[model samples]
Each structure stands twice: as C-alpha cells, then as structure tokens.
Target: MTTGLLIVQILNGLQFGILLFLVAAGLTLVFGVMDFINLAHGVQYMLGAYLAVTFVGLTGSFVLGLVLALAAALVFGLALEFLVFRHLYERDHLDQVLATFGLILLLNQGVKMIWGAAPLSVPLPAFLTGNVALMDGILYPTYRFALIGSGLAVGALLWFIVEKTRTGMLLRAGASNAPMVSALGVDIRKLFMIVFAFGTMLAGFAGAMAAPILSVEPGMGDTVLILAFVVIVIGGIGSIRGAFVAALIVGLVDTLGRSFMNDLLRLFMSAPSARATGAALSSMLIYLLMAVVLFVRPEGLLPARGRT
Candidate 1:
C-alpha cells in the first residue's frame, strides 16, 4: 500500500476505535456494575438509528431528531430496566442470558415491524458532506473526522466521570464488590439505574453517529454487539479505562488487518488465494485477538477488582 493509503487506514482505524469504545463503554458498565449479562444492549443502538430516522423525518431537523431519539432511548432503556432487568439482579447469569436473548428477538422483530426489512441511512447534515485532504493525496470524509473528534471528546469526558468523580468511585466500588457497597447503604439499586441509563445513551449515541455512515437496518446491532463483547473481553469488564484501550486495539487491528491483509498475503502467495484467505482471516482477527487476551489474562487486561 502507498504511504497515503496507510495514513488513511490509520485514521479509519482511529475513527472506528472511537465508536467501538463508545459502545463497549456501556456494555462493560452494565456487565460490571450490575453483574448482569445484557445481550440485548445492541438493540438500543439499532433503536437509536431507527428513532433518529423517524424523528428526523418528522421534524425535518437532524438536531431535533438526535435530541428526541436520545430522550426516547433513555426512556425505553429505563422501562426495560424497570420491567425486566431489575428483576434479574439476583438471578443467575444463565437466566439473564435467556431473558436478554429473548429481548434481542423481540427488538429485532420490533424494528422490522416498524421500519421494514430494507436497509436505511440517515442523510448527513449538509455541512458534514464532503472530504478533506490530509497528506499528499489522501482524502477523508469530514463526517468521519467529526466522529473521531466527537468520540475522543466523549472518551475524555467519560474518563473524567469514571476516574475523578464521586459517582465514579462508587461505581468502581460496586464493580469490585457490589454487596459491600450496598452494605454501606448507598441505594445500590439507584446507582444501577443511573449506570444503566447512561450506558444506554452511550450505545445509542454510537448508533446515531454511525447511522450516516453504516447501513441502518433490523439486526444491525447484532454484529456490532459481538464486536462490543470482543472489546470488553479484551479490555477487561468494569474498567472504563480498559474498555477504552481495548477498543482502540480492536479497532486498529480489525481495520488495519482488513486493509493490509491482502497485500501482506500477496507477498507470499497467489493473488486470488491471498485475497480469499486474507478476507476470511481478516474478519476473524479481532476474535483471535480476544481469545489470545483471554488465554493470557482470563479476568481481562485491566480487571475491575482486586488482582486474582
């Protein structure tokens, strides 16, 4: 690959890493703090895109759609928390999996029923359309650049919240040992709700930001959901810091692997064979990375609690 192509791929990786970080941030918190396995979390992302499309269509304004969609996502998430997830706090992980898996089915069908089966995309705001030149001949989309900026800004904000704030300290405590924190009488249930809702918004925001770039459709979140899981596994659940680092790692690995795999393989074999093998292997790269991490550190890279 040319130097320019390499630069573009790096930028692409960074942008994608930011999005993964956003999604995984919530997933890790939900898993870590509440000790709940929420397989349905990805649906929140799908709903965010669908809601944005509907609201934007109705209001004829992207900003309005975003605001309304965020509100709707929070409301729906809270409803789910109250109606279903709340009851499972005391249940086993298997039950949480079964219930949340059912939720995935419900949500996928729900989106199809409301939005149809066809893929969709929200129009980018006029100002976001177009590209910018960086190095010699490389050009990147402005909207994607915006996404990177926004994601990093949010990452910084989240870091501050999780690392420096009082609520963050409580969350860390809860992640490490929820029973102990509850024993202190902090209304652990309320803390759970706050974490749940905030995480939902983060995942939803990722969906909304991605809608303009990625295909928006029923079950779209399913793939991203798996990726989010990979992120948390690699990062170490309950640690926002871990999620951030692992996300960037996965993003860079996935993006760069896909971009360069064919070329790398071509160096050793036939072009056609290299193309086919590289494509399949590239797709598995992140999972392989996750598995390797698990092998080395079963609890994850930066586990939430005391060292095992």
Candidate 2:
C-alpha cells in the first residue's frame, strides 16, 4: 500500500481503538471492581446513541443534545443499578450473567419498541463536518479526529481519576479486594454504586460520540459489547492503562489486517483466493492476538499492580 493509504488506515485504526477504549474502560472497571457480569452494558451504549438522537433532535444543538443524553444515561444507569443490578451483586456469577443477559434482551426489545427498528443518524456538528488532509490525495474526517482527541482526553481524565484521586484509590482497592475494602469501612455499596454509574456514563459517552459516524439502531451495542469484553480480557480486567493500550493494539491489528490482508496475500495466491482468505483471517486477527497475548502473559499486558 502507498504511504498515504497507510496513514489513513492508521488513523482509522486509532479512531476505532479509541471507541473500544471508551466502552472497555467502563466495562473493565465494573467487571474488575464489582466482579459483576454485566451482559447488558452494551445496551447502555445503544441507549446512549438513541438518547443522543432524541436530545439532539429536540434541542437542535449537538453540544446540548450530548450533555442531555449523558445526564439521562447516568440517571438510567443508576436506576438500573438500584432496581436490578444491586440485588444481583450478592448472588453468584451465574445469576448475574443470567439476569444481565435477560436485561440485554429486555432493553434491546424496549429500544425497538421505543425507537423502531429502523436505523437513525445524528448530524455531525458543523465545525467537525469537514475533513483534514493527512497529505496530498489523502484526507480524513474532522469528526473522526475530534472523536480520537476526545477519547484521548477522556482516557487522560480517567487515568487522573483512577490514579490520582481518592475515588480512584478506592476503585483500585475495591478491584483488588472488595471484601477487604468493605471490612475497612469503605462503604462498599456506595463504591459499587459509583463505579457502576461511572462505567455506564463512559459507555454512553462512547455511543453518543459514535452516533455521528456509526448507524444508530436497535441492538447496536451487542457487537461492541463483545469487542469490549475481548478488550478487557486482553487489557487485564480492572486496569485502565491495560484497556487503553490493548484497545489501540486491537484497533491497529484489526484495521490493518482487514485493510491490507488481501493485498499482502495476493502476492502468493490467486486474487479470489486471497480475497476469501483475507476476509476470514482479518476477522480472526484480534482474537488471535488475544490468544497470543494471553499465552505470553496470562495476567495480560500491564495488568493492574496486584493482578500482575
């Protein structure tokens, strides 16, 4: 591939990775700290996009809609935590899985009923609707750049919160040993509530940010949920740094593999065969990478201090 195309692909990969990080960051925290299996977290992402669509439409301002949607998502996530998830916390993992899985189905259908099955789109803010050239004959969407920048800013903010703040200290402690933290009078329930709410907001923010580029529709979060799981598995559950690094790795591997597999393979095989194999192999790249990483470091790259 030419240099320009390669640069474009790399940018695309970073953008995709950023989105994954946003979702995985929250997922890993909830899973790592609370030790809760929230199969329905993806639903939160889907809800965010849908909420953005609704709010943006009503307010006719992208910034206002995004703010409103995030507020709503936080409220809804807390409500779910209060009414449903909190009780499941004391139960076994099986019960948590089953309950959350059921919530996934319920919410997916609920969205379908509320928003219809048709896909929706959010208009890009005018300022971000243009494209910036990487070089001659290559250009990237300004919005995607904004997405990447915003995601990185969030990552930094998250790092500060988790690494430099009292709340983050508690989160790390909770992840390391929730029972012990509770024994020390940390109010484990309140901590769990905070973690859950924060995670839901992160996932929702990812969805809202992605709405301008990705199709907004029913069950949109399911695929992302799976990817986010894979990300945490690779990044080391409970480690924000791991999530951020692994996300970029997964994003680059998947994007580059898909974009160049066919071209690379065509040198050694028939065009049609190359295309077939490339498509299949590209799809498997991230999982294969995960397997390789796990084989090398069972705890994952940059696992939380206690974990590694």
Candidate 3:
C-alpha cells in the first residue's frame, strides 16, 4: 500500500478502536462491579441506532436527534435494569445468561416489527459532509475525524471520572469487594443502577455515532457486541485502562491484518492460495491473540487493581 493508504487505514483502525472502547467500557464495569452477565447489552446499542433514525426523522437535525436518542436509550436501559436485571444480580450465571438471551430475542424481534427487516440510514450533517486534507495529497472524511475526536474526548472524560472522583473510588471498591463497600455504608444498589444506566448510554452513543458509516440494521449490534466481549477479555474484565489499551490493539491488529495479509502471503505463495489463506488467518488473528494472551497472562495484560 502507498503511504496515504496506510495512513488512512491506521486512522480507520483508531476510529474503530475508539468505538469499541465506548461499548466495552460500560460492559466491563457492569460485569466487574455488579457481577452481572448481561447478554442483552448489544440490544441497547441497536436501540440507540433505531431511536436516532426515528428522532432525526421527526426533528430534521442530527445533533438534536442524537441528544434525544441518547436520553431515550438511558431511560430504556434504566427500565430494563428495574424490570429485569436488578432481580438477577444474585442469580446463577446460567439464569442470567438465559434471561438476557431471551431479552436479545425479544428486542431484536421488536425492532424488526417496528422498523421492518430492512436496513436504515442516517444522513450526515451539512457541516460534516466533506473531507479535509490531512497532508499535501492525503484527505480524510470530516465526519470520521469528528468521530475520532469525540470518542477520544469521551474516553478522556471517563478516565478522569474513574481515576479521580469519589464515585470512581466507590466503583473500584465495589468491583474489588461489594460486601465490604456496603458494610462501609455505601448504597451499593443505587451505585449499580448508575453504572448500568451510564453504560447503556455509552453503548447507545457508539451505535448512534456509527449509524452514518455502517448499516443501521436490527442485527448490526451483534457483531459489535462480540467484539466488545473480545476487548474486555483481552483488556482484563474490570479494567478501563486495560480496555482502552486493548481496544486500540485489537482494532489496529484486525484492520492492518485484513489490509495486508494477502499481499504479505503472495510474497511466498501462489496468488489465489495466498488470498484464500490470508482471509482465513486475518479473521482468526484477534482470537489467536486472545488465546496467546490467556496462555501467557490469564488475568489479562492490565488486570483491575483490586481484582483477585
């Protein structure tokens, strides 16, 4: 690839990583602090995209639609927490998985019924509709640059909140030892609700942001959800810092692998065979990385500070 092409791919990988971080950040917290296995979290992402489409159609403004959709996503997530998730906190893992899996089916079907089984699109705002020159001859999409900036800003804000605030301290404490935190007079239940609701908003934000670039369809969140799981596993389940670092690693590895694997393989094998083999290996690269990580550092590269 040329230098410009390589630069574009690197930026793409960074943008992809940022989105994954947004989704995985909330998921890791919910799993780590609350000890809840929420398989339906991806549905929250799907709901965000759907809600954005609906609201944007009604308002005719991308910004307004995003705000409204995020709010709606938050409320919907809180409702799920109150109605379904709150009750499952102390249940067996099998039960949690089954219940949330049912939720995935219900919501996915519900979206299809309401929006039909077709993919949807969200238009870019006028101000962000074109590309900007990054170098003498290199240009990149304005909206994508904005997406990267936004994700980074949010990541920084999250880091500040988790690393420097009282709520964050409690969150860390809860993740390390919920019973002890409760014994110290913290309202553990309320904290958990806050975490879940916030995480829901983050996932929704990721979905809404991605709607313009990717197909906004019923099952779009499924693939992203699986990737988010991979991110957490590689980052260490409870560590935001780990999630951020690992997300970028996975994104760069996946994107770069796909872009160059065939070319690299062709250097040593027949073109046709190289293409086929490269495709297979590229897809498996991230999983192979995960297996290697688990074998080498089972607790993950940057495990949560207080986790055993």
Best by lDDT: 2
List TM-score per model, in order.
Answer: 0.97, 0.98, 0.98
Report lDDT (Cα) of residue 171, candidate 3: 95
What local lDDT score does residue 261 receive in model 1, on the 0 to 100 scale? 96
What is candidate 3's TM-score against the reference? 0.98
Q: What is the lDDT of residue 227 in candidate 3?
A: 87
| lDDT tens digits, residue span 111-224, model 2 | 999999999999999878989988777889999999999999999999999989999999998888889999999999999999999999999999999999999999899999
> Per-residue lDDT tens digits of candidate 1, residues 42-100?
99988888888888788878888888988999999999999999999899999999999
Ordering by lDDT: 2, 3, 1
**Number of clashing pairs per prediction, in order:** 0, 0, 0
Q: TM-score of model 1 relative to the true fold?
A: 0.97
Which has the higher lDDT value, candidate number 1 or candidate number 3? 3
Report the C-alpha lDDT of model 3 over 21-92, residue by residue, as the tens digit.
999999999999999888888888889999998998899999999999999999999999999999999999
Residue 244 of model 3 has an lDDT of 95
